[model samples]
Target: MPPSPVVPCHSPVPDPSLYEPINTLKPVVPDVWIADGPVVRMAMPCGLSMPFTTRMTIVRLRDGGLWCHSPIAPDDALFAAIDALGPVRDLVSPNQLHYAHIAAWKRRYPHAVARASPGVSERAAAQDIEARFDAAFDDAAPSPWPGEIDPLLFRGSRAFGEVVFFHRASATLVLADLIENFEKEKLTRGMRAVARLGGVLDPDGKAPLDMRMTFTDRGAARDCLRQLLAWKPQRVLLAHGRWYERDGVEQLQRAFRWLE
Candidate 1:
């Protein structure tokens, strides 16, 4: 009999052997004080079809409950560490492609109100991810951490639209899927080829070409970038790869170099 064709799935399907639920290799980053409060950074080994590491951010709201953004996969050690900070009251998925771990966090923090990025609910519905988005974020910042975190929604893309955030206190911009900064030495041989072809490897990493091409409204993206620049970020945090500890504004300008 002739071999049947392999149907490709554009979804988060964790390859059991390569996937690590929690970031077991590194220690949780210490908290950094932002404009209105402090935020903690956590990491995990993620990726379904391929393998890569990702990060999440946790901020304490005025009500003393934690607000988690783009949550990472959970494990016992990570859970204990998160518990030490405070009660987790809010969980968030910053982009459609970032909701894989939100369900895990929700399971652990049932009291937490989970917010999904625009179109994430639909994405979750199609995938095996058990996520119920309590609400969705738009270009405007939400009330939970109002006046401190500014959210910018980049529309006109069905591939994976993302809502970027700028934290006023620390002058730090947070992103998911929009920018990936991977060092040449860090990637596997296969990923190295992928990163090279996508033009997102090493010191000058930006969004992949596939993602950039999906952006139908560069005008909207440009305006959004302008809004973010007004914040004058000093650092940038990324979910996919290394973050910028300095020259954040310059990094943004470079990351969006294709816009102009």
Candidate 2:
């Protein structure tokens, strides 16, 4: 008889390992802010769970309307803090996997338009996740913040599509999962192993190996990358791991080097 497979036993990382001051606004630039939230255990290959630290980006438009990207789990204090910033006008899901919390945010801000990324609505419905969207993101930026924030669909991956944003005022590029830079100190031994294997650890983070492989059409992805670089972002904000505060273009180039 064949020997039983040996499964690794690893404890989940403590919540404190996540970004501090959870669910509160941390200023990234004059009009842009980021909020870190509780850890979400995402299923990994081999029957493992990878603890992902959730993050969300908020941009205050010139009209005093707040634009939220990849909103995390909602709480009263977080909502109150968001209200203080301005009226919630746009709640966005940057990618299909990031739409789980949009329903909660919609309940809190009924008037706010819940914008869905490509295939997000279908993904949610298949997962039986209750979420509604007033409109879907396209190659061009939508109204209310047209020139303020530019949106681009980073295509090529048939599995999922992510809408990346470039905030002109702050020169900040907002991303959901194109690049994940997990800090080693904040991870459990098991998670660190996984992050290392997935190529998502900080200082050399890029798209996870699995995700990079999905880009069968590198040409289309390259076209998207060119547009993002054209923006010449000064700062790069990501939904997971430590974000790049400077040299946005360089960081982007490094993260997506696989394309070349």
Candidate 3:
């Protein structure tokens, strides 16, 4: 038989709205506020109207400079708001799949370093997206988070390339779509049904999908889950769902029940 045809997986090109500047900011939780002033955190209603809330973390550097992670596209008003924070210093596309507005942000913050994800270079190139990251995550290496944060690559599995981050000072664990916890009522009708059928939702909220279907090796995934359990975080922040305030470690364990 002839060699199997190579099926190219193209990177998704986000819509124009993704780059639009933030017009308002709101606090979804105490201490954790959404900067909609020039950068809004939009709730992405995906999968049968299931609302997956995404956030853009904007920080004002000590040197009167600003930095943003998972930035949206630039708007004149949003640029002004970002300018007020300080000069743009860095733009981070934290994961390969989260590079929607990276190109626009890079254009606006020309002086800012664009930190790309591990597989971004090849994936972006395939889509003709000319963006690059200054640093990439190494599964075995330590993260350079200015001594304030640490990152660990949840390797041993090929289903998803996830690098979980830990903010030391705040004792916050940031996850990138590895887990979710939104209530079904908060989602659209279609999404609610899907969540119900998937057994990802309960009266309290939706849980993370086991996602074992995507894993190339179950053993590897199980090992990574074990490592995550060892972290013992106080608070868990998910990229696609509600944040876990207390007893985060238990919640994590419950979400990954398949590994047990």
Please report the candidate that would top lDDT against the real structure.
2
Q: Please report, in order, the local distance difference test score of every candidate based on alpha carbons.
A: 0.70, 0.91, 0.59
lDDT per residue as tens, model 2, 135-246: 8876654544777988888988978689888999999999989999999988988889899999999989888988998999999999999999999999899889999999
* Cα lDDT tens digits for candidate 3, 1-260: 99999989795653332222234333333323234222223332342334444556554434545546666545677677666656877676666656767778777777788777667677788878767566676666655556555666665445456666665555666665566554554566666676666556643332345454456676777787776667677877655545677787787777777555
Residues 105-130, candidate 1, lDDT per residue (tens digit)?
88888878888788888878887668
Query: Candidate 1: which stretches are off by over 4 Å?
Result: 1-49, 140-142
Estimate candidate 2's alpha-carbon lDDT, on a 0 to 1 scale: 0.91
Give the clashing pairs for model 2.
Answer: none
Superposed by TM-score, candidate 3 places the C-alpha of residue 181 at a distance from the truth, in angstroms, of 2.9
Model 1, CA-based lDDT: 0.70
Error of model 1, residue 242, in angstroms: 1.1
Which of the two, 2 or 3, has more lDDT?
A: 2
When sorted by lDDT, best at the front, the candidate numbers are 2, 1, 3
Model 1, position 141, has a per-residue lDDT of 46
Best by TM-score: 2
RMSD of 2: 8.6
Superposed Cα deviation of residue 32, candidate 3 (Å): 6.2
